[model samples]
Target: MNQWLIVPVAIPAMIAAVLVLAMRTSMTTQRAISVAATAAQLAAAIGLFVLASDGESRAYFLGHWPAPFGIVLVLDRLSATMLLLTSVVASGVVLAAIREWDTRGRHFHALFQFQLLGINGAFLTGDVFNLFVFFEVLLIASYGLMLHGGGPRRLKAGFHYVAINLIGSTVFLFAVGTIYAVTGTLNMADLAVKVPQVAAGNEALLSAGALLLFTVFAIKSAMVPLHWWLAPTYGSTSPAAAALFALMTKVGAYSIIRVYTLIFGADAGALAGIAQPWILTLAVVTLIMGTIGVLAARSLPDLICYSLIASMGTLLIAVGLASAEGLAAALYYAVQSTVTSSALFLLAGLIARGGEGRAPPLPHGTLVIGLYFLLAIASVGMPPLAGFLGKLLILDAARTSAHIAVAWSAILITSLLLILGFARFGIQTFWNRPRSDGAAVQPLPFALTAVIAGMVAALAALSVFAGPMMDNMTAMAEQLIATQGYIRAVLPPAATAGLVGG
Candidate 1:
């Protein structure tokens, strides 16, 4: 009877369907529905967070069937956190989109709601197969949003994005099939129990399964080599779309934390032996490359995109450490990066709008320049900001895990790159006298400014609450590392190998 677990996923989906009915007749009605749906989702998310804080895990079996045979939805602290973050970001992006609403706004709202549905479902689902379904839901909605205006550039980027993710989804399907074939269950909790029992002789199969799953997640998270599609895709999309994309990438990062720690702990640790070193090495490479990309970038949006890539690498490096502290840092950084990056992207949009949608040939006024400097400093991990706190945590984790050299090197090099890149952007956009064409710039909308300001305030609040936040993260990390907490929450005690009936 604990239906609260289902409300977050179902409300958005139902509202999306309702929007389709009203799409042809009343645009105002559709917009209201969209905003109301997101608000409802936000409310549900807050409620779930309160429930989760009480340390209860709620599981709902579809059709009232039990465990392995039936699909399940599970809610825990991590899922609740993700749902809350997703709702807040989605609501912000939706509200921001209202400033630029077009005739297609109905479709846009529908897609946004559906996308949230996918994201929430992915976080809540107890079945791996359902995760794939939810991922596809997210992708399909994203495809529409990415190409919503249907420009040549967006279409081109959308093509590449969709094609690459489709392939990733195919591989995901194969991995699911393999896991099911070997373990005979797609429920994550069931597989968490069954997978380790895979015959020793068939360890190779399980490893391959794990690796395939890792690859799918890697591409989703935009880890180094698999990150080719991100910069362009984000750069081409609208700021609202880009903000949503920022949250989407974290879903993959969340999966890495959730699945690797919960379901494939021993396998992940073993894979870490082979994979962790390479991930660390590539994390350094990605950090340097992304920083360099930012420095050399011609536009603010591109700079933000590349910065995001670099941040993702940093989080992955934390994940590679496979320690409780490392995981906590990664989680902390994931939340921090999402808020900061999205805010920066919105700032870039505001900048472009101020310049009349064209890049200024030279810098503007000193006041504008000063604001740019502050934002740039914050993005580059200046002290007392959220980024600084996150980077410090990551560096501490890496050092404690004995990756001292890699840790220090990554911190130093990335800091230098960020500073240099932002310096260049600040100089170009603000320091020098504006070109003849740089007449008085228009002010950005109050709503947009308010949203960005709210994000910055939230980040500051997070810093102030760091003590309690880190405590929760540390406890969650301990629970994850122990694994038994998750295992017992998801599966019943009697369930075991080979074809256990639900």
Candidate 2:
């Protein structure tokens, strides 16, 4: 079980190859294998999550290679949490796609598995270079998924998506190269140990590299100004793909949290928190713009896409607080919002009319409407759901920050905007529209409904067990802030000294 750190990546990689090479023509076979692999992944992730709950960081050196030199997968509370989230989302997304979405195009099942491989690898890798490699893996797979249910709109959006990511990839390589050249290592643990000791002459160079790294991550996370690619891309993609993609941005957020805390953390001397100053300010702007986009949206997919951005804004604010409480809050919110975003995207597929531009609402009868309202309330951070609880944690964390007023104002005001946006869309979707006479109304598919209910149920469980979840998150945050534990866990004993020195 200790070696199962690679399960998240290996399971997907192996199955994806099998699906591509052998099961390409058999939809039935592909569906069966893909579903089984995803369930295996979920089970493995759960095992890893329980293992990580002990709070000690563990490293799995690949091919028996030592840390800071060869490939490694490190499992800590954060990585374990993300792995679980990815596996959970993949299970639901695959289930949703099996019915009709995967049949829309060739290789969707393979692409989806590859997407999971990339996402899981991104979360688990201990090397910065491998992180970039996983990023490419996921991005390439996403291109195919984005165009799975092809349309002229998807083609156009996919092109922009590809082009934007290509630029980000190029920047990512440059940043990795710069960091390696300066620090003499690409391993995150090694970098953490070495960053604090950088010579004064190299401080500026390292700072530039660090900031450049954040730039790439910000692009991947869909931060504002760079967020132009998200709405168009997500809105055009199929709902199942879009739902899975909700985890992709978290890859970026996870990278930001990981590198900033471990490598450029408070102990990094001159390089301490190089990316900190930009996070909160940009997060606020991001939330505001996303809120505006949500209100301006004319279609369900488009609206949900913007709302996803707003949720990112809120999540990042907790992250930018640069405190243990903030990290805990951000982690909690990340889980909640990820599920809520997926739920809304799936709901969009069921409820919206099929066509381009300003997709008028198609009545989805009772079940879908009920799910939509439930998700909408959850998405808008209304009470009694995990979304609301996550936001409250964020606000409480922000209370101690010097930027308390700004954080509160931004969160509270944008929350109102989110509610208004969801309300406006909901009224048009469920309330004001008149159903045609003598028209046959199709009931929602039980499978899709069940998949969605599972996600909602996860959110409900988070709310129901909010205390225990937050307690774990707090311990995880403590582990994150105490960088020495990670440094010791990954590196040889002799190497850990002086690297984590504050």
TM-score of each model, in listed order: 0.92, 0.97
Error of 1 at 483 (Å): 1.8
The parts of candidate 2 lying over 4 Å away from their true place are 353-364, 436-438, 499-502
Every candidate's lDDT: 0.78, 0.89
Per-residue lDDT tens digits for candidate 1, residues 310-355, read 8888888888788889888888888878988888877776666645
Q: Considering every candidate listed, which one attains the maximal TM-score?
A: 2
* The 10-residue segment with the lowest total lDDT in model 1: 266-275
In candidate 1, the residue pairs with backbone N, CA or C atoms under 3 Å apart (3 or more residues apart, or in different chains) clash, namely: none
Against the true structure, candidate 2 has what lDDT? 0.89
Q: How would you encode candidate 2's per-residue C-alpha lDDT over 29-66 as one tens digit per residue?
A: 99999999999999999999999999989999899888
Report the CA-based lDDT of candidate 1 relative to the real structure.
0.78
Per-residue error at 493 for model 1, in Å?
2.8
